[model samples]
Target: MVVYAPAVLFFLAFCVGVLRDRRRFSNAVFLGLAAVFALAAWLVELIREDEQLGRSVVVGLLVLATLGIVVLAGFLVSNGVTMIRKEGRSPANLLSLLGGVALVGLLALLVAAWVLHTHTLLVVAGTAVALAGYVGFLFLCFISYAFLYGRLHIRRRADYVVVLGSGLVGGSSVPPLLASRLERARAVHARLSVRGRQPVLLTSGGQGPDEDLPEAHAMADYLVERGFPAELVEREDRSASTEENLRFSKSIMEKANPDYRCVIVTNNYHVFRAAMTSRQVGVRGHVVGSATASYFWPSAMIREFVAIFLAYRRTNLGICLALLLGGALIWWMR
Candidate 1:
């Protein structure tokens, strides 16, 4: 019972963070830690109650964890194959394949280190394991928080519905991915309208070198073609990236109404990152997610995590370097 205090505190912090502002990434980290400590506390309690029962539980959990890893590796490999077969062999589609192969290779390294009984192999495997553990923890935090955030109901009415654009399919055509976001924005607008609130729907994007038109223009056109009111739709067509999208849209919303509240919309895979960005840019909004294709989600999610990892590269890189140094010291001692 005393051991559970840390878990209780972490959960309280998570609740407070979410209540104060739901967009912070730290909230996710807190929630993840809460779950981890809760599990640890349970394990301790089980061990205290009966040593044999505890041992059985521990062994069963380890077996399940191992099986989960194996299954995950297989799924990634299979999804990679499906991506290649269906979408062609672009670099983006190759992420899951590369990840799966890398996981298998890492497992192999651990086995070789054990079998060979070599200090050098052990050092290498140990370093890899430490780095992977750190990354896997952060990833767990991210995915769990993302899932939780996406499912939260937005009860407050919004003054605006902002749709973040994905690139067009051809030179000017609205792709299914971008269309899904527009459809979501339209639905939000419709819901607000039915509630007697005239919320503005803003499309945010910019022209790329190969694009025939700005993504915002294409998105707005798509909504118009589908019979959403042209008058309520506005365009912010200068943002080149997601940060720029939020920043530029914030400027427009600010001028029209300095205190405007809004809902930003993107795909489910992208919702958490967008929410974080919206907060960064000082937007008074919560984000909502549209649907994404199942085959495309794994690679897309990997890309999102990579972007986030790099965004906090200073801290993450510092941690990895420290782990490497620690591993080096152990090898030197041997």
Candidate 2:
């Protein structure tokens, strides 16, 4: 019973953080910690009550964990193949496949290190494992919190609905991917309108070298063609990236109403990152996601995670270096 105290505290902390601002990444860490400690407490209580049952549970968990890793690695690899086949052989499309190969290679290295019992192999495998563990923990937190965040309902009225653009299809047309976002924005707009609060829909995207016009213009056109009021559809056509999208949109939103509250609409895989970005750019908004194609999600999610990982590279890379140095010290001692 008492073993669960830490879990309870962490859970409370998670609740507090989420209530304050669900966009913060630290809230995800707290939630992950709560789940971990709860599991640990449960295992401890089980061991106290029945040693055999506890041991069996522990062994089962280990087997399940290993099997899960193998399955995930295989799935990522296969999905990568699917992505390449459907979306072309771009570097972005290779992320899931590369991630899977990396995982498999790490596992093989660990196995060989155990078999060879050599200092060099041990050091390499230990360092790789530690780095992977850190990354995997962050990935878990990201995925779990993203799932939680997307499902949360906003009860307040929004002054605007912002749709972040992916890109224009065929240089000037709205693709299904971008259309999904517009549809979602329309839904949000309709809901607000029903409540007698007419929120302006702000479409944010810029002209690419290959694009016929700015993505925001095409998005705004799409909305108008679908019966959205032309006057209500505003375009911010200078953002070439997500950060720029939010930053530029924030400027527009601030000029319209300094204390404005809004809702950002993007794809499901993008919602968390967009929310984080919105917070970063001082946007008074929460992000909601539209459905993305199933085939595109894995690689897209990997890409999103990579962006976030690099966004905090200083802390992440510092920890990786310390882990590597610690492993090298162990190898030298051996």
Q: Note each model's CA RMSD in angstroms.
A: 1.3, 1.3
List TM-scores for all candidates, in order: 0.97, 0.96
For residues 252-330, what per-residue lDDT tens digits would candidate 2 score against the true structure? 9999999899999999999999999888888888899999999899899989899998999999889989998999898
Local distance difference test scores for all models: 0.91, 0.92
Backbone clashes in model 1, listed as residue pairs: none
Candidate 1's residue-wise lDDT over 282-333, tens digit each? 9999899999999999988887888889989999999999999999999999
Candidate 1: segments with Cα more than 4 A from true spot: none
Q: How many backbone clashes does candidate 1 have?
A: 0
In candidate 2 the C-alpha lDDT for residue 53 amounts to 100
State residue 70's C-alpha deviation in candidate 2, in Å: 0.8
